[model samples]
Target: MTAVVNVFLKEGVLDPQGKAAHHALDSLGFAGVSDVRIGKQIIINLETEDRATAEAEVKEMCETLLANTVIEDYTIEIN
Candidate 1:
């Protein structure tokens, strides 16, 4: 099974990296980019074939190690 996790900052959180990227884009003349939010993607290969089990395990991984839940949110996809 393959699990993919996308982790990103919460809406109200200030993202310094995102801000920097936005500024850079503006300087480079990439106009009309109103905003940018940075995030991370993690891909994991699991031995289990069950999609339910993979999702559950990946969710746990996100909660325990992959994300700081207080400031970030995550979505999980299993295949």
Candidate 2:
């Protein structure tokens, strides 16, 4: 099984890199662009055949290390 984790800053938080990218886009004459937010993707392949255990482990991994819970949010997808 494969687990995919997507980590992103929560709403109301400031993302400097995203801001810079947005600014650059505006400067490049992309007027339709409004906002840009940055996030990260992590892919993990598990050896376990049990879907329940794999999901539990992946959630634990996200909570423990993959994401900053205070300022960041995450979503999980299992395949």
What TM-score against the true fold does each predicted structure earn? 0.96, 0.94
Candidate 2 lDDT for residue 44: 99
User: Which pairs of residues have clashing backbones in candidate 2?
Assistant: none
Model 1 stretches astray by more than 4 angstroms: none
Q: Compose the digit string of candidate 1's lDDT tens values, residues 38-76.
A: 999999999999888888888889999999999999999
The clash count for each model shown is 0, 0
Please report, as a residue range, the 10-residue window in candidate 2 with the lowest summed lDDT.
29-38
lDDT of 2 by residue, 7-76 (tens): 9999999999899999999999999997999999999999998999999999999999999999999999
- The candidate scoring highest on TM-score is 1
RMSD of each: 0.6, 0.8
TM-score of predicted model 2? Answer: 0.94
Judge candidate 2 at residue 27 and give its lDDT.
Answer: 94
Error of 1 at 16 (Å): 0.6
